[model samples]
Target: MEHEKRDHALLSASGANRWLACPPSAKLEEQFPDTTSDAAREGTLAHELAELKVRNYFYTTDFGKRKLNAAVKKLQKEDLWQDEMMGYTDQYLDYIRVVAMADRIQGTAEIEKRVDFGRWAPGGFGTADCLLLKGNQLHVIDFKYGKGVPVSAEENPQMMLYALGARDMYGILYHFDEFHLHIIQPRIDNVSEWTCTEEELLEFGSYVKERSALAIDGAGEFCPGESQCRFCRAKAVCRARAEENVRLAFSQDKGKLPPLISSEDAGRYLSLGEDVKKWLEDLKEWALGECLAGRPVLGWKAVEGRGSRDWIDMDAAFGKLAKSGLAEEAVLWEKKPLTLAQVEKLLGKKDFQDAVGEFVVKNPGKPALVKESDKSEAITNKVTAAEAFAEGGES
Candidate 1:
């Protein structure tokens, strides 16, 4: 599956959350060139593969099937391709089938449909991964291949913008009464959805119009917060964000603490700590980049950090070890069983479950403090302790 090239809007739907919060950031980010990371490239590959599968399944023809097979072969030859991608994509396909069945309407499914919402947002348009229209209902399904952060469909600016664009494009023909936004993150096993009435969707569209007007010209004040700043291009040197985190870090007089801090103060500091840490890391990365580019930071200089050596020819090295009477299993190599996930992918899901499902057991995850808005259910201390004890006894 070859990657498709798409033009990005200045106020891209994907970056709407950032620009909507801090309007000036849309302009501020323009000074920096857009860059793609390995993770991003891998995600692009995954999306391409997914689109191929969707087209093949929904609009199947002999030629389309042949094209799909050829594309899959090309994707497999890519450097980023992994064996697990097939299984993950199959899961996504299964979910799409379920959604189609639930819709109960033999509606049309468009792949990589381009939509425009320029009526509300100036020059706002994006490609939706999939759009299923079923009897006055519009379904926008987005595939998120990244595993680092779980994205939700509830009031998500990106998904909302996608939905808005979709509606503008299809509303006249379909007279949509409801909009369904879905995010499927197969890598992290997250599937989230949010449905909105036409009235609610229009109300949100008006809000987006107001914000887009401000964001297009970078007319609003800089609002520095965690979620918006996380992916901002200028975050490394953004004075507003720096001041925000710095003020939080030194809120107490002389940056000092009392002899004993109250629990409330401790909780506040802990929440602030994450932002401060991220800011510090960004600052260091910026300085390193400057130094590497031959621009001197006040007290920084680029230098070699560390290095390690590896065998030039593993087979030759191992043969030499054997000549010295070293047992292959003793030092050269050792056998280990595949991890649960690796085995699951190696054998299909049903086969793997039939083979070793009884031997497999899942332990309770460790408890961690998170924001109240997190979707995960809160665990009580009693349950945590009991689960810990149960695992200990089993061991």
Candidate 2:
């Protein structure tokens, strides 16, 4: 999959979720440069690792074996390896196997399978994380490494695109009548699934094909919304989005009656709290960018925040301090690495943790509500069986 050049498609299935909503997004995005992030690299590595595992165990194919091995070696050398990532991949493999067994199929798994939707989507093609066929049912599984937001499959265009593409690629031979789409987002503990018949699938395709064609020609309509704009590259300078957000502020600022806000007004403002916060953050980023380039922003100045002191040459400074008849301990705070409780009055947080970080004590976090599916093992745990049994017996 890495061998394929990402030809900056006018429409791609991965961005289908965004382009379908804001049809002009793909066209506008072409104006900005595509930058890779650490998060994206980690996601790619995770996908590679998961694919390697699945193919090694289930299907025995040497497709991209040499390239895959090299990529796997490169990823294994990275510091991004985490237990949960491996666990998530395992869960994905397990789910596929379970489904395959249930449907009386074996060795139907296809890893990193590229599918082309042909005329159903213009210049549309994407690699499904995993694709398999079981009788008349066609199951498409996608793995998402993001923990930010849970992606749903209800009317999901990306999954729909993959389904259509897979249909185009393998439909001739298998003649799939049923479709089951699944999204496994392990980082957020979100496992979402949706099923649709072949008839309903084609009905949704008509809308995608038209939208995709318009998007490819840069003739798509500009529709702005929170979901559509979240991952958009042009969002920072998009006039439509700026205007939409400005309307909200305009609605809030008109005709102020009293010093104290009414309950209704307060509730409305509270409802828009997230939007306001994001706007402020974007404003700060813009102001900083302008300030750094020596273009001063009105009513805002750039100033350095509080900074810690550091010696120009720590070893030389220590030697110089000792030569000046001052003890080394006086100039530099030196102590054996140990906990405060274990060795009290040793050093301050600035002195010790700054120098010997291993001795530092990490703070325990506050309690917060979290989903049962949360794998953090944080917040709090429910009552254990033993505790429940003891309480029940006591009562």
Candidate 3:
């Protein structure tokens, strides 16, 4: 079973999750094993509960406290109700209550379709959370319960993918004019709507077919951006993460801890290392210029001298007060001392010791990267900002 499972090309949005962060995320495939954290499990549980609530609303003839109780029971049967189950029960009840209330007026309870996406991947597969069938139209809804950034359903790639799947599955069953993508987040007071057009769906379907092929060929490593990296599974092993760290180190001017390359970066670096190294040098040069001028780039700081404090010579200042019978502690005042490199070194325990044992601290460049404003005569041929920016374009 394990062998068969391994042989099957089961594509997941997980790799896409990483690729969205950095193109070279695939390099970490072997190095970084996937693990499900609490947040992921919670999301899964919440989604299951939401699905149950929707299912009960659509299928059940009864719509009252009895239905709410039934929904709660259904969630428990699915093993989704655990620790803080009442909160989810309340949530399910509230949603049903809202739908019930809406039904009295216009735009009430409607179940368009459930689990209705047609063909998704290499295999004919798609997901349908719940669809609302209401007055001459269909409304598609997907539940998002994670702490991740809210995705707008209109231009959202995931929703479009789902929509494409829906078009393949449900268009024939029900002739629809307008499509609505409703994103519901119970944890957050989020109820977002996105209207999609037929033309848009067609275009998105074509995109999915084209992109799906890349996944089939195992080429899902195209990097997206920094914000996306926070949720990536391959963050530790992603070459983009390494490159980002390198870029950040150079950009900040404080030297970063030695180059920590992930396995993915190491693989790609075997061929493209030289080019990346040159880019790093150029980036560092540019960073140095900016740092010297005290410009903030990347999340790094300029080497502040050291933090220190000074105590006033109380006897001198408090002589009159002491003679009049005031205590020394009463007149003693502490003052902040000026920061300097020497005091900074003294701040650390090992740094405070003379050359001896493990306690001895060596001059390890800088804790972070440092950009010197003024260069010594020995430091010649520094790459300037204009040179660094123009180097690639000139070619």
Candidate 4:
């Protein structure tokens, strides 16, 4: 399948949450050149493969099958292609099939359908990965190929915008009453769905319109929260973000520092430390980039920091080592069993579970501090009497 170039709008649905919060960030991001990473390219291939599979499955023709086969062959030749991508894309297809079956009414699906929501967001348009229309219900399914973060459908601005765009394009023809938004992230095994009434969607549209107007003109205050700033191009040098972090660090009254931080204030600072740490890392990365580009960063200069040596031919090096008195098994190559995940992937999920599911045991994850909104259930920390006494030291 040939991939078509997509034109991004000023207020793109993918960056809706960012611009909706900090309307000025939309225009600010334009100053930086758009860059694509290897991971992003890999994701594009995954989506293309997924679309081809869906096309062949839904609209089966000899020509379509041939095209899909050709595309798959081409995809395999790509540098970023991985065997796991096939499994992940197949997982996505399975879920899509399940969704199609859930609705008793016969449905029609559109793959990579361009949707325009200009009614709410001015000139706002985006492509919905899959749009399944079943009588009065419309399903907007988005396939996320990245496994870095597990995205949720509930209150997601991107999915909401996609839903709005689908509604705008198909409302008259389908008479849709409810919109079901789905996020399928197969790599992380995250499948989430959120349902909302037409009225609710329209209400959110109104809010998007207000923000869109501001974003187009770059006319709002820069709100620098973690979610909005995470992907912002100008985040590295954004003054607002720096100011926010600075303010969080120092809570002084009238430019005078407090003698000591209270326990309550310490907890608050700890919560905000992650944001501060991220800002500092971004600042360092930006400074390094500037120095590397032959631009002086005041006190910073680009220099080789550290270096390491590696054998160019590992097998030859091992062969040379084996010629010596050292045993190959003991010094050259020590065999180790494959990881559980690797074994499962090799054997296939069902087959692996059937073979050793009873023997497999999953340990509880270590406790970690996270935001209140985290979906994971909280664990209580139990302090034993011995531990309390040890801390007190013979109290």
Candidate 5:
């Protein structure tokens, strides 16, 4: 299905993770006008390209190949196509094909499959990137082209909703026993997979039914958190979220007291860190948006941003150089192949392992101050929990 045909509803399945947490966000977001960024458009194109490639592999190659090429050329014409985008899509295709190899004889695969959960969520519908079914198990593969943050599949509400929707769509047709959720974020080398039985999925459906009803009717409370408000449209103007952050961040640590943080307070601060970071970023963006639109905030005003220059017409410049009779090699130099990180991203983990793994040089990065809950060990070896307090430093 073409992404252009995909409609944006106030309670979309993609934003289920958000609205389910902060139920009022569904209604709050409606008040703000919907707008798509260039990144979103590029992601749409990547999804289109991925759909085309997967379809070609499974069904039509000669005819579908033509359509795929045409779609790519159109995107290239608009300067939306990039080498990196295709690499990401290719990684998605590679994963699908690899999984297909496991059940090559019995598995059924569908691309851009639509699922509707309007029974619980009013007008709830979304297209799954890919679904593979075999015997009683179904695999739901979602391709996230974004590189900003690594998304995990373990108990991920978004992927769970996709699984629920898939079950609703194909439950009767195929009596699947297990649903496997796969989130392949090629840019971040994040390939997380989680499996849940039909019982677990149905249990989640109960939660979905209760929360979705509230969100669809705009009746649930605005309980704020990092996961919910990170991409929320109303986060900047969310009174509940603002209040929650202020309340969480306002510490009662007196100067007379010991600098050591109690275990409970440390836990609380850790939970607040993500939300505070998101709130600060969202507030900055909101202020900037308001200022750019000629409605500057009373206290915070906008200044010219750090800007860079770009070539007006690179082709024109190259064309003139071509006619000047200078050696082509002298005018334009060949670039070396991308570095390890770049090549790994270009080829993906599996392909990179097959092609470039032998060339990788492993090294440990210098660790910094991370939460006590972090998996990695601390860089400073002297102290552990209250290292900051032991030293003459603020906790």
Candidate 6:
């Protein structure tokens, strides 16, 4: 797909996250242009399956309980509930009402025409997913399953953009007083929701259209924070990201910096360390690339640094042990793992004259997770058990 076309798809919260993090679209546009990852394909499949499951719950069963069971079963069959990593996400807030069936609205049964919500770019247009009627209100639901932070359906620019598109699409065919944007995050442990007035949606739509035009026509580039950069498609070529990687190599401890400014600001401030380290790595890459091209970095000083000691005196020590007629294994040197802090403290100790000593360290282990019962469960269980007894009217 063209970069512009892909950008429209990415306007959705999840889409933006994917573009910033993996930059698959930019990578495809650049080198090895027609490649796709299996992981990405699998993720799409999982979402399609999830949508089908939710649709079945509403359209198939009349009874709420039966619909729920059927929806759960359908989800299971689609392999959504089976794939441990793919199906179950740690971030899911809640599974509100799985396979929730909704009553159809009067005006939503008919299809709406596709209209240009607004111009994303000179030639680009933003479009809505679809408009469904649920009772008297016009329900607009957007599906998002990515691990990125979830976007609220209410007042979300993306949803507002879609609503604008829907308004243009419906035009004279239908009149919608209230616009509801429901965000379905099936991948999460908890389902989230957001709602907005039609007026709010219209205002958001206008704001984003102007913003989009500015972004596309504007000079320079979108220099979002590292978190936003995580999803940026131009990351490999992005100057900000290159600087971030360089800085990360130097600063292993994040807590050393002052907390006055945001960590992001601190990172930018620390970009100097990254620049130096990145320059070294770039030099190495250049040298290697040159050698491969039959041009070598001749006469370049290969500086040496102090490295770990060689066991040169070990043979003499072993020979002495043999001379003493004792086990050679007895003279073997063994080292133990130590934390950086522990090593530093030991180095300062006056009694530790020898540079070498065997040290052992082991973790105490994980703490157990047991909580006092609230008695709520016991009371509920007893009440339910008694109710069942009354219903049965038997022992």
Winner by TM-score: 1
Candidate 3 — which residues are off by over 4 angstroms?
Answer: 1-9, 12-33, 61-120, 124-126, 134-136, 251-395
lDDT of 1 at 78: 84
Model 5 ranges with Cα > 4 A deviation:
61-67, 103-105, 253-256, 259-270, 304-363, 369-395
RMSD of 6: 18.1
Residues 1-395, candidate 3: write the lDDT tens digits. 01112221133332333332333443445444455667766666666556555656555665455765775576566433454544543464465455445534344343323232225446423344554544435566666676455555656655555556555555666655666776766555555678877776676666655656665555666553444555555544345556755654455435665577786655544434433454455455546656779886686555756889864874665886777787766545556674443553444323334333344345644333222321212333689889897885765
CA RMSD, predictions in order = 3.7, 8.1, 20.2, 4.3, 7.2, 18.1
Best by lDDT: 4
Clashes of each: 0, 0, 11, 0, 0, 17
Ordered by lDDT, highest first, the candidates read 4, 1, 5, 2, 3, 6
Candidates' TM-scores?
Answer: 0.89, 0.74, 0.49, 0.87, 0.78, 0.46
Candidate 6 structure quality by residue, lDDT tens digits, 1-395: 11122443333433333332333333332432333455455455554444444444334454355664564565556433344423332121123132123442234421112335434313333433335654435656555556445455655555555566666666566666777776656544334456666677666656555555444333334443444544344444455556656555655555665647786775555653434554455556546656667775785534445789776797897788788887665545556798645763656333333543435345555544222322122222245777788899965
Candidate 6 Cα misplacement greater than 4 A, ranges: 1-36, 54-116, 119-130, 147-151, 218-221, 240-395
Over 219-299, each residue of candidate 5 has an lDDT whose tens digit, in order, gives 878889887887788888789988988877785655686678798867777777768877988888988989989996998
Query: How should the candidates be ordered by TM-score, best one leading?
Result: 1, 4, 5, 2, 3, 6
- Candidate 4: give the clashing pairs: none
User: Could you tell me which 10 consecutive residues in candidate 5 have the lowest summed lDDT?
Assistant: 373-382
lDDT of 4 by residue, 40-62 (tens): 89999999989988877778874
Q: Tens-digit lDDT track for model 1 on 217-309?
A: 889899998889999999999999999999988877566567898988778788887788899899999999999999999977889989899
Instruction: List the global CA lDDT of all models.
Output: 0.86, 0.76, 0.52, 0.87, 0.80, 0.48
Kindly report which residue stretches of model 4 are placed more than 4 angstroms away from their true locations once superposed.
1-4, 62-66, 253-267, 312-330, 381-395
Q: In candidate 2, what residue range of length 10 has the lowest lDDT sum?
A: 341-350
lDDT (tens digit, per residue) of candidate 2 on 1-395: 56224454568888887788888788899987776778887787788788887776664466456755675677678786654466777777787777767845643777788788756877788788888777788888888888887888766788888899888877677888889999888766788889999999999899888887778777767887667777778777677777777777666566747988887876666655545557656668767878888999989988888999998898998898899888888556767676564443345334555676775566888886444445557644689899899889965
- Give the distance in Å from residue 209's predicted Cα in candidate 2 to where it truly belongs: 2.3
